[model samples]
Target: MTSHRKSLARVLAVGLAILSTGLLVAAQPGWAAPAIPAAQPVAVSAELTTADADAWLDGVLPALLEREEIPGAAVSIVRDGRVLTRRGFGLADTGISGNQPRPVDPERTIFRVGSVSKTVVATAVMQLVQRGQVDLDRPVTDYVNIELPTRFRTPITLRHLLTHTAGFEEVYANMILPAGTPVPALRETVTAAPPDQIYEPGTTPAYSNYSYALAAYVVESVTGREAAEYLQDEVLRAAGMATASFAQPLPERLNADLAQVYPSRHQQPIPFELVGPWPPGSLSASAADMAAFLLAQLNTGGSALLNQQTLALMHSPALGEDRLGGLAAGHRMALGLFEEDRNGRRILGHSGDLIHSHAALQLYPDDATGIFIAVNGSGARADSATVLRRAVLDGFADRYFPAAGPGPSPVGTAADHAQAVAGIYGLSRTPQSTFMRAYSMLASVQISADDAGTLTIPLLTDAGGTPVRLAEVEPWVWQDSEGHHRVAVRVDEAGAVGAIGVSPALVLLPKPAWQVMAAPVVAGSLGVLLFALLAWPVRAIIGWRLKAPLDLPRRDMRLRRITLTAAAVIAVGVTLWAGAVMQMSGGFSAQPGLIRGAQAATALGALGLVPAVWRAMRASRQAHKSRAVLATLVALAFLGFGAVALAGGLLLPDITY
Candidate 1:
């Protein structure tokens, strides 16, 4: 791995360990959505005895809380319409010693539920569909006033948005808006930065917050009500989730019980996260509140939210193979639910993360059981939360609903298939057309093969980055050592591996050597730029030390010094300018003044090298020896850096989005 790859891996790990708060977890291995076919969600008759289920959670939840240093967490188990064990384990508001603290009340204390709001919002859309007021297959423009910009001729429909096949590129603008910012209406926020459709409608799957915002926009326009209002009356309230509110900041009545976000175990709590598009990820609710929705899901519409038929359709698979980037074999996309195949049994659920808060809601309809986990704090080691959550859920499934039999005979771990899948893989969620896509290098996703013939995917490793050897279970399907997760590879027509689906939420594909190698070039070239900036003064000191003056014409020496200084200044100034832009909110969407200055400086830096190149050439021909050679290197290095900056859009003329 190169320096850039290491740096990017750290960035990706922290980013994923956290999924931009543990969302789409472009960073951590366990955080990704592995492939599971969508076709198998069923309503088989199954049940869980409350005593065993409650005993298991009682033994596990606190142990995880203690081991992981998670400040507060709530777990709810709903068995056949009965709240089995919905309780809190730690403090909800661990206020600073000088500040007032509130212990968690799982039944009443509300936590920011993250993207689980998508599921809730989807239910609202299905409710409208049930009423004949909203058609899932109808084009969105038919319901909303705005038009989605698309390269494809197919129109985006409500059904496409529901299944996440609306094809809108991911948009993060004000998605997690900064504190103290006024919350914008859902429609205003979606229209503010409408993402272009990167694929034809229903042709691909990309996890997007914007898609749901548009779906909510359609819901609002059709009903003449905002999303929060509609969800409050139609979904949250009807499902008996009284403690749940889709509003960004909780309503005044519920604000007092709202939980604060903690980025680290010991760091002072951060301010309330204000999301502009509340529909996508802004719901704040208690574990008990979330259970009501789960109950509805497991029972297939016990609430007035939607009819049983619409609810079943909402839970049914929307896309099968996920044409763009294949999802895990047994996982599939439904209206809002992610139907997961695990342990020879099926589970439906969704996970949410906004950095400081993490949540997972799972429903096992066959067993008539569902589980919800919400953690109130996060840190660099946030993968602990994911592991803990999955452990409890998988443990419940195993203990309560054990696999009927053993899996297929395991092929040797070090099979030819393992060697074939080996190599560097990059996250598929990367920005393809934008320079922001350059950050994909930071992901540093890789799969290495051991002599055991087993493949080790580092991302799937434990918190310590120790990889797990995976055995090929079937063609293109690899199972983890623990059998808890699996990877499905997609091959092109030539039968070459094109991409690997870890889950419906993420896909990994081979990264070209040039891209992996670009990091070293960037690092080495940047170092040269710094040296060029220092050369003139250093050379002057050398001359003073020897008590000698320059032998070259004053004009040539002056030109060399001046041009080198310009190149150095341009390079350093642009770097500082970009650093400043990165500090500001929404810098990715719009460049700040420093960034513009850097762009201008990079251009000036490129031109500054011309005189230095001429001086070096003149000196070289005259046998100036070392001076000419060094000058030539400086000029070339400056030009290389400038070209890279320009091409990569690191500097101003290309700054506008």
Candidate 2:
């Protein structure tokens, strides 16, 4: 008996250990561990036309500011080895009591270049690769002596670190500790508790600052130097970015011309210390300095910083097929930069955003055109980088770089028609009840001209108050400096604002007063009903069946049959009700609205079956007999359909575009 007990104890202990191991393995985030390819040679030269490109940059600067509501911005356009245009505009600090308000001057003033610093870091890493100091494919663990959690499937590598596929959790916001806390060294942060796995390594792609932080540590370990020091010695100096430095404390030399970074909405100065993970976003420099760096990148293959082959590898996408934004097709990542084909032209670029700064640098290798923008205010949204880049490209296409002649103005008859055409229009309610909830509250304009018109429209903010001015981009299209786009308002024959048509991409709209009042109430009531029905089985099991079913078998049998019949009827009724709601919303059409309603209905219907199944099982058990599970299964099927409909209805707006 003692021997048996010992054997059982051992089995139990082993099972517990296995369970713990399984849980640990389940907790680690996924990383992409792709094999790094052999470096490919790339031709580098500084010979490209810049005349037309310079003119385009000049015209685009103001237009961009007007569209994005950016208070101040510095822009530089570079082609081949030449600087096309470098200019600045607006006030850096808008607040009255803050530092002196200054217009952005690309030549003299330094501005935080945000995540574009990643490019510099990438370049620095490549320099190490060129020198044969670091192996791109080697596990980062080989360089650093940090005890990582056992859950990571494959070891993280330099390539994974660069491409942001290092299975690290997005810990940027969380990494900002309170001012006085003992800051963990880079190694401590990398090997910190692993986050839960969203997917297996290489199967999922998520942007993570942890990867960059880890890479920074790897750089330090390999070079026996801090990340900032290595970058300055290896890349910045070689690229001729003299004003640039990764020092988080703001180097004194560049402080005099440093643009005061401001919070966009509140008009407050941004605190520098809050900019966490310096390796990714700590660098600051002037537009001219950045332009010089662009020129250097375009010119020589064997620069002191990185070889042309390594640079090419850094620019190529580490991930397959996935493109950032809709900017390009088959887009891929290089060390710190992204490479993609835009309009049949291969383009290389990086965008950066810190607490109170936004910046982007793009190079067209074929056209030898490079565009850079650095904003001192965090007024621009994250997605605005793509918009700004596209606008610059559009201006470039018009030969507006060196101030090409403006297109013919549609000022007279066409303008009037466009203005008249500009009005609020809303889509009629669909059978699926997919009409936009905010249509009645917000307004859009229809312009008299197709492309040229200047109009100011009011926009509804989050709070139910007055609308703010939004500058018109075209006759009907309006956008703010923050890249918020809207349409022109149209008046009907009755002169009343009837409906608003916003971009199909605009998911959040001003909720109407009625909708605001009704939505929560409806959602709450439905949710409660769902929960109650689902809980009925458990409640019935604990309350009545267990106690009486075994003691008074015949009576229990009768009671169980009755209970099962009642539960089935109720389930059928709920399923039918859900079906009715779905039908009212619309049939299972392919439209997003219908799909959402169907999902909701399906969820409701599926939940209705729990009680029925519990009752049937209880009855069968009490009588020691078999019964068909068909009714419960049918209820579940209906529930699934309802759920699909509901999800489709809720998410319709987001998927509409």
Candidate 3:
């Protein structure tokens, strides 16, 4: 969900934006530079020394936890193919009193690894590829009983799935089934209501949890064991990750050791999360055990699960473009890894975010050194988890892998391009063919180019939480003032901006003007519709109370009542359903009863407008010219509102988030 969460998170951001100011995108805060990592590691008698790691943790971690209100975290450091540090800081759980807390255990406490599970799944697939039982280039349907049903004839392969280029549109609805609820078979979870194949297979990159779930399904088919069992018996056991388990609910025996994930320091811990698909994420492991896994990965040929050749293939850039999805600047997607060229050195890693838990695992395959950290949580803070994860890795890089300079400064953009990249960009992981498309507007990013050729997007804040101003460094590439982040826009042959970034957070494309402005437009349309519909009965009552003799035609009056009745139903039905959907964004059952009924009522109301319009036209032909003109205008307005609502898919039957 770390990747898919990026898309859904955009929707929540908009709600906050609407409250903060009108007509402005709020800047997302960025990770503050972490405290310095251990100075150049010195081997003093070969036992892991706490001097360097302790310096950073003592000076930085306590303040970080206090500032972000994060409860606790577990960190593991591996260097030169040996475990260097395994430590936990802060409270793992606070029994009841906010004043009392239980400390996390680095050696035994389990943390949900979230999408880090993808890497393990990738490892499993590679294991089969090594056995020649799975073909990386073959269509996925060969291994799983499912068809991509894509628009193009290009059959999606395991390579495409692992690299997230299979073109599966992300569907967040019912993605996380209840913990106590039964989990469907892996095949059923991956295949049911398959994502719409928006792009050609092996084309543009899109982050997808569904793709990884399919990867898990493939593992099950090949190994003749449930994926969790295969992962436990084969991957986890072979890698020496003794304390790890892909088992959902974590098998009660291990639950006692699981760290309690808090939504925020102030909130109570959420009960155990049960991932329905059970593939993209669900693994729980301890920091100490993860160190063993990292050591095995670093030891390539020495690894029990994979050969050096297979490991190399997994770490190389399997999917390359100008840039990669959801990765930092100058990076590309490589199988399950994000390969980045940082300061002339290459590293492969990935980050994962479950609802209450977040994790990052990265390693310099060549240097055989890396850091892994998982936080209980930083509440609803936007970039707190990122803050913790990157602090550990960035600090590690700065200390161990020093750079020559502060990297290159940004380039400049053409003066004409100032307006070329201006517009609202929606997240790429949105539903392509569902009412859920409206959710994209919530996750949109607004960009404007000034006459001075500077790009003004409230992209991210520095560690200090101040917005970072960005300007064009090279054509569509924009660099932050700190030069810490870069965003590149993809322009089509026609010179239209196709996409706005290399990373998923910045990779949104320009949305339609109407779609972007739907906030005010939809609100206004519905406001007018409700006003006119309610005025119908109000006007009739007023006229009767005034003892006025209605000289209007009975047919016209009857038509007005019929249309008003339909409009009332439309307004009420949608209002109730929308309120309910907003209140419960977590899970929307497949069959939305009242929501579907709302769709039917709205459709009938739209049809009823035809006769209403005709009557208003007839009324205009009568002597009461002023009244008739007003009626005509109201009818026309209602018709216009209905047309806009339908086109925008505001009234679609499948109202699942």
Against the true structure, what is every candidate's RMSD? 6.2, 19.5, 6.9
What is the per-residue lDDT of model 3 for residues 1-657, given as tens digits with 9 covering 90 to 100?
A: 673336345443443342121000101123111111122332232233466776766677777777788888888888776787888888788664453567888999899888888889898998998999998889888877666668878889998888777877767666556558777778788767778888776655678888888898899987889887898889899888878997777788887788888877778887777776677778888998788888877773377778777777777656434223222223346668765334434567777777678887887787777678888875547677777666767666655665444433444554567688777777666666665554565456777777777777655455555656666655666656444545666666677877665453224667887676665654554565677777767877888999875566888778777767766766765554464455334332334665576567667767767866887888888898876876776676567657655664657655644
lDDT of 3 at 118: 88
Per-model TM-score on C-alpha atoms: 0.84, 0.53, 0.83
Better of 2 and 3 by TM-score: 3
- Where is model 2 more than 4 Å wrong at Cα? 1-51, 150-153, 175-184, 193-198, 319-329, 380-390, 397-657
Best-to-worst TM-score order: 1, 3, 2
lDDT of 2: 0.49
Model 2 residue 495 CA deviation in Å: 53
Tell me how far the alpha carbon of residue 571 in candidate 3 is from the true structure, in angstroms, after superposition. Answer: 3.3
Give the number of the best model, judged by TM-score: 1
As a whole number from 0 to 100, the lDDT of residue 450 in candidate 2 is: 40
| Per-residue lDDT over 1-657 for candidate 1, one digit per residue giving the tens place of the 0 to 100 score | 011112222433332221111112111233234433223342223346567666777888788877777778888888767788788877777776455777778798888877888898888888888889987777888887786678887788887887677776544344456667778877777777677676677755556677888888888889998777888888888888988887656679998887766765566887777766667778888988988888877764365576666766776666545444444353556788676556656577887776567787888765677889888876446366666666777777667665544445456543676777788877654444443443554345778776655677766654344676666776667766445567777776666777776555545668887666645555565566577667667867888999875688887878777787676667655555445334423212233565566556667777777887788778788766888877777777766655555544454343323
Which has the higher lDDT value, candidate number 1 or candidate number 2?
Answer: 1
Best by lDDT: 3
Candidate 1 — number of clashing residue pairs? 33
